[model samples]
Target: MKVKRYVVDDLPQAVQMIRSELGSDAVILNTKEIRTGGFLGMFRKKRVEVIAAIDEASRKPAPRPAAPTKPIVRKSEPSEESAIPAVQLPNAAVRERYARSTGTSDAPAVRTSAVPSAASAVAVAVPAESPSKEAPERGAFAVPDDPRPARPVQAGAGLAENPDTASLLTELRSMKEMMVKLSKQQTFRSMPDSVMNWSRRLAEQGVEAPIIERFAEEVNDRLGTEGADDESAALSVAREVLLEWLLPSAGSGINSSTRIVHFVGPTGVGKTTTIAKIAADQSLTHHRTVGLITSDTYRIAAVDQLRTYADILNLPLEVVFSPSEAQRAFKKFEDRDLVLMDTAGRNYRNELLVSEVNSMLSPGEHAETILVLSMTQKYGDMKSVASQFAKYGVTRLLLTKVDETDSYGSILNLALEYSFAISYITCGQTVPDDIRPFDPNEWVSRLLGEPAYA
Candidate 1:
């Protein structure tokens, strides 16, 4: 075997060099990212190191044979015909035949056959040309071209007839797939230490892998390997990338024109508390006439909790037991500037429950639904709730319990994946105090564990 090593910018470059130096039959043994030419690890250049090898026997050309003596012709018996020796066809002819037989233009063509028959083995090899006028001798065998279109061959259909070729192709395919997986897995490892740490932090924060990869790519492009060593620089670049991802969904709080806002989510996500905060802000700070409605009779305390806030804020409160009653409650608050309707929190992971709660929501241009999710919840659970609500066109999001979890990637995950407009986020249970409109800058800063950027 002939082995060679190459250091290149990427896998494609290494592949091109290997093919040129070691021929097309060469296989890659291993590949990894390596850093070089740095003084005290300050300004190293990152490159891919690839090891490739090719069989020496395959690389060396076959030697020419000495001239052969003439063969003595033996007379055939009366009932026996003369048998012709098998002809060795060129590689191009064998490939053409294999392609036609398999109906695949790129099928691997091999020299030897696993099963050979007398007729096929004795067939005379010919050059690519039109059929000759003269007929063949009585005992000679010839291959005729078929005019019919080739049929599609099933996978591994011809493998049993050519085990060596099939094995080679399968091994090559496996190697290619392995290389692709390794490339993806090592993508973040190629980044500088500071940048790689942030990638890990984002993953630990529950961010999706694709989003983290894109963020890392953007940061690496901006800072490069040398500058990425500076943690501050990496954080600054990461902040900008995250902000760009989140800015589209920022400042998407409840519109002033919306008169009825329905707060919906799973249990223990602080739906009632979030309603109170928004209602208080609207009534006291914006001076809008706010009315409260609740369909939370499932838990008597749920209704009483909102009633307590309504009494303290001097806002009109209405309670409904069903969708029909909800209509009547809306009529009573028809004159109010803004009505905040709170729905009973159920296991929204169940589509039936989502539909039941969805039935009570006011559907019109004047109403909006806010899916309240707790940041402390698992990302999978949050995604499930969001997906169920999304079926009913609930695009607005209000994340609660932000102070309870250190990981905020779920916020960005929800925003980017579902395109949910994050309207508000609550850090504490304090009504109208801990809750505020979603701030992209502050949230991105927190996600990266950095101070809020200017």
Candidate 2:
């Protein structure tokens, strides 16, 4: 099979090229419109790309039956020249005209001379004349003693009636049907002008298209149902729907009997610093007995940094290298009212590292696992990063670096997408001063571009 691709200005040109190169047996496999030569999507030219194929074996014409010839007569005394009977055949032009006149072309004219046998004359007679000569010049017809198999009458069918042509038409119809279905889908995907306006607004605010579409669709539905078509009414509906669907994470304070908190997130997400701030609050501000355990032994000077905070707060800091050692450290701090576990910030995208961290903390046994994400990162990246942490265990969301960007769409986006509770928001790097528990109403107001709730 020979397959080719052609890009042309229109369908007719593509068809002509396919016909000239692949002949009548070619099949169109696929076609699509493509745009090229655009700078920033301006002044682009559209072209049609067509894919066609031809099966080399199917393109060969089926052999037709030759015209019957008379048997050659051989004299008892054979002359040298008479020994081989000279035969002449009609040229292709004569054969074509004969076919048109009689509605058949299986038979052609053949002139025969006297010879010894039917096979000898049949072989020797045909080579005697040039194929370019006319039928009359080739002489009269002859019938052989033993006739060859006759070509089927159906072999003379027109090009349109050919089996290969029928197969090609079927393929073309299938491609046309597929193209129609794709066009319908393209039409269905085009959004209304109002919906598109909202989509642009959300995109400017750094919200992903899928999330914007979901909100816009719901807003439109509510407006239609309430018999309101105004833009302000639509915006109001959108805000209300978003607020209603934004389910804030809910949780009770840690168990009074024993409290353990583990902080986990990707690299440089402020996991260690966040833990320090929490430790200072629990020990100094809340006046509770707090012990700190860190499995951040992978990096240089990590223990020193945490130890400095531990020394200032006068709290015991135990650094463990392995999961078993971590278990022992927890056992040693069992008498304390609260034990804060700070894990090293590594690539959580690596499943092995996440599993190792899970083993080290033994989360969900008695401790609350918090996944920390940064508001500075894109929502698209945050979703993937959060999912990797979610695989092990994540009870709450500890969103950090809120002061870095005014847009807080990532907070709302993650809340709706993953269904995880927003636990705390860390705005600045200040220990114990910048971190605060999440407030649902205040966050919703910020997301809607309104004044934050007091």
Candidate 3:
């Protein structure tokens, strides 16, 4: 199989390029929207990244056969009687013994044509001089040698005693062992000690297997075997590759034109706390007028919690129970510079609930939806929640509970797998102090075991 990756402006362009380069037989393995060529996560151009592959064996034509050659003929010699002789049992006991020895039925029948002449049958049965003691006794009957060629035994034919079958079984076992070794060599096992150590570190940090292999390959490709064996050189190249992958997904916090921001995620992910942090940042740090809206009527404490933050910040708070009431809240917050809306957290793994929450938000270029995820959650569960939100066009992410987890690879995993722009990350429960815009450099440094600012 031949595999290639293409980054293009759109899916149609990627399809056209794939067809032209890899032929029509090629298929797309995966595709996601990616941002590139931005300074400090500003003015980045959005592009579609596609992974395509084709089987080389399927594309090649089969070899044609050679033309037939004329046959060579020679004169025939006078035939002696055939080496095969007819079997003639003298009595019922002899016939039964012959049948038991040869694993055949004791049916009494004889073919005269098998014996070309009586002399030929006598010569074959008598065996030139005398029978050896090791040879079994033939009681007045001759066992004919079969002239047909032996059939080849296929693999897995269950012939335990056949030498050819045993040899084939040995070869199959050797092939399986060789294939397993080759597969191990393709992964981190074949890398130099230093490079392999780095790969193990990445895996221990929760990095996906494919991403780790790609990182090891990049290290080996950029630096040769000697350089890869050097710990410092391998670490340096791995850091560069990770930074290149992460920087593109770093977001610039909140856009100026985004008037309303909807914060949505699964239950217990700190959605309300994250909203309070963002609201405080916008109002105090940026000196912008900020308002708060909560649609979390499902839980009484949720509404009370946001209201407390509103009281502390001296900001107006609006509580809405339904989509119609949400529109009224938006109308009231139209005069404000920015409005951060807090949604009720639910089991967002259910698509129905996600769509229910999405219906309450205003959709337009001025509105943005942020899916807040907890870093301590399992990557599979987080992926499920993000996938549900992605159906509703939620592309920006705000990760919470960073200090609760030791591994940070899920941040990169979400960015690369779902193509989500990580807007902010909260490290603690502190409202404004713990939250900050995602910095790709700090994150990559921390991921690579470098000391970073807390």
Across 1-454, the per-residue lDDT of candidate 3 in tens digits comes to: 9999999999999999999999999999999999999999899999999999999989987875532232121112323322223344444555566567657675345322122232332222322332323333343243443333346646756577678988898999999999986886776566777777777878877888888878888877887856866888888888888899998899989988789999999889999988888888899998899989999988769989999999999999999989999999999988999999999889999999988999899887799999999999999999899999888778999999999988988987898889999999899998899998899998888787776642
Per-residue accuracy of model 2 over 1-454 as CA lDDT, tens digit each: 9999999999999999999999988999999999988889999999999999999999999986654454443233443433333333435544554456557645354343333342443232322333322322222222233444344445536456778988888899999999987875564365345545655666666776568767767766676744344666766676677677664564333445547988888777888788888888888877789999998888788889889889888999999998899989989998888998889888777788888788888554567888888988877678887888777657588889988887877876787777888778888988878888877666666665654531
TM-score of each: 0.64, 0.57, 0.61
Candidate achieving higher TM-score, 1 or 2: 1
Off by over 4 Å in 1: 1-137, 140-176, 451-454
Q: Per-residue lDDT for 15 in model 3?
A: 95
CA deviation > 4 Å runs, candidate 3 = 1-187
Alpha-carbon lDDT, every model: 0.80, 0.72, 0.80
Worst 10 residues of 1 by lDDT: 109-118
Better of 2 and 3 by lDDT: 3
| Least accurate 10 contiguous residues by lDDT in model 3 | 67-76
**For each predicted model, how many residue pairs clash, with residues at least 3 apart or on different chains?**
0, 6, 0
Estimate candidate 3's alpha-carbon lDDT, on a 0 to 1 scale.
Answer: 0.80
Task: Write the residue-wise lDDT of candidate 1 on 1-454 in tens digits.
Answer: 9889999999999999999889999999999999989999889999999999999899778875532233222234323333334334655665576567557776352323221233343233433431244443342223433223346657877785798988899899999999987997797677788888888889988899999888788889999757978988888888788888999888557788999999998888998988888888999899999999999889769988999999999999999988899999999888999999999989999999999998898888999988889988999999988998898888889888988878888988998999988888898988789988888989887887774431
